[model samples]
Target: MQTENVTKYIVNWLKDYASNAKVNGFVVGVSGGIDSAVTSSLCAETGLKVLCIEMPIHQAASHVTRAHEHITQLKERYSNVSDTRVDLTPVFEEFKTEVSLEGKQATVDMALANTRARLRMTTLYYHAGLLGLLVAGTGNKVEDFGVGFYTKYGDGGVDLSPIADLMKSEVYAVGEYLRVPHSIMEAAPSDGLFGDARSDEDQIGASYPELEWAMQMQDEGKSLEDFEGRQKEAFKIYMDYNRRNQHKMIPIPICEIPNKFR
Candidate 1:
């Protein structure tokens, strides 16, 4: 890939889109992950007002440290970049109190984890509406398209996704070119929705490189019969996720009315 050209193209695209939409700037939820760091940097390069928001709900200390470090560095490097921290822990707790925590333990835990993401999404949109900014999504190709790892109507809710086409490795490359904070660039990729330091790999059971390979194979129409041992296992994992999360990757289902009914 032409790294420099791609970088310039994305920056120009963002600027043009914002100008066409008549929005003052973009609001990105910075999670101290490679995706958000790279995204916020691209928005800053547009020379438009970019707001980096930190909405933490029972977030791990390392994640918090990295988020603050990245935001501070971004503000220092780009005059148009600004930031605000919203502590959503209390709000999350209050919400839990109002909802029933019934059902299986694992199921309840998963639901709460998704709730954290939704709360952060709401916060980002709230700021976007108030500041006349577009909600910039930080999802990458693997998560957004390959695995569908993000929460729908949560982190998946966005006005625009600047990095959705870039693979995870490509996102890291862009982050390197953008000079994202070292702490964030090196930290294990995570959703940070579970309020723990567990990496995305732990949840997905496959590293990004492995998933990328599987995605490529799937794209090439390869199937389980073609591989053995670890490759088969990895391929199966990728296929399972892709199959189950097709809803996220496809358009929402709408019932069409019959001609006679109209």
Candidate 2:
């Protein structure tokens, strides 16, 4: 589809969904990254009240800095835009202590990252509930739906996702078309999990283009047998992540008896 048509379609989709759900506005967690920036812009374009919240933890300096710049630009771009800064270090630390994950650095980091996402979700829901608004998810197709690169009840919990069907490359295309900040569009994508220690590519060991290609193949009903060497590896990683995180993508199982119970 054409870029303009896609943008309009997504905007209208969210608007209609929100209206039907009795939501008057949207709350988005803007990480000052391209995905969130694009999602925020689209939400604002729908004439919905867009609340862009910047929730940064101790390890996410670059993300925090970029968030401020994006928020400034968004303020200039949209009259209904509002920004909030929330530091999640204290909450993460307290949660870590309560969970007794003191000496486990990797475990603590994972927990802390999830805590940051959940904290942001909580803040968004708080404002959204008060304003009768929906929480807009910033996840892209390649990450959230394809690879499950999001927290279960954290960033993954949202009332609506404006860009969930778009891949990373498509999202960047929309970001460029929307005139999102160049720095954010060019910056390396990360989960802002471990400061400078890790990034999305570093954790996944494959770039979005490669992963998206594998996803496209899967979408086209092609089998992994068609790929060879590195392509196969990429597909394996994507499939592995999908399999491992299946629980996160679905609702909890419920016990059911048979027709007798009904």
Candidate 3:
């Protein structure tokens, strides 16, 4: 679909979500990346109070700087928007102490990364609950649905996802249509966990364009027969992530007991 139509669809979608949930606004984390920037812009355009949180740990100064720049640009374009920065160093340190009792430091990197994300989610949900607003997730089709590049109950948890159906390239198209700052649009995408330690491309060993192409093929019902052995293997990895993280994409389950009938 065209950018304009997509934007309209997103705006209307948010409106419907707000009306149904009885929320006055929406909250999103702005990580100085294209996806978050695009999602924030869409939320602002929907006429809801858009709260952008810049949650950076000790290692992510660069990402936090860019987040400020993006927020400035956003404020110029939309009226009902505000931003706040919360350093997550202390929380992460505490979490590390709590988990270090296991004597397993090998997973510390991944655990810290997830802690940062979950801290941001906690803050977002806190403010969202106070304002009676929904939390907007910034993940795209390539990451969340295809590759599962989010932490469970952390960044993956949200009330709504505006860009969940759009690929990374399409997200950039929407960003361009909305005139998102060139700096943000061109900056490398990262979770800002380790301060240039690892980027999305670095972890996945592929660029967004390549990942998007693979995702499109899968979406179109293409099977392993349509790809080479290596490609099929990579596709299997992606599909496995999606399958394993299904619980993260859904609501928590509840148990029920049968009642005797008269």
Best of the candidates, lDDT: 1
Q: In candidate 3, what are the lDDT values of residues 1-262, reduced to their tens digit?
A: 6989999999999988898888898899998888999999999998889999887777666677678888998888889999887777788778777766454564766777787888888999998988888999999988887777888878888998999999888999999998888888878788776656367877766677767777777779887677887677666656666677777666689766667632
Per-residue lDDT, model 3, residue 155, is: 84
Mark the regions of model 1 whose C-alpha exceeds 4 Å error after superposition.
none
By lDDT, the candidates rank as 1, 2, 3
Candidate 3: the clashing residue pairs are none
On the 0 to 100 scale, the lDDT of residue 25 in model 1 is: 94
lDDT of 2 by residue, 1-262 (tens): 4888899899899889988887778989888678899999999888878888877667567777788888898899889888777777787777767776677788777776777788778888987888788899989998887888998878898987889899898899888888888889988898776556366889988889988987887889877788889988898888888789888777888978899778
* Candidate 2 lowest-lDDT run of ten: 190-199
lDDT (10s digit) by residue, model 1, range 33-66 = 9999999999999999999999989899999999
TM-score of 3: 0.88
After TM-score superposition, what is the CA distance of residue 253 in candidate 2 from its true location, in Å? 2.4
CA lDDT, candidate 3, residue 86: 78
The per-residue C-alpha lDDT of model 2 at residue 15 equals: 86
TM-score per candidate: 0.99, 0.92, 0.88
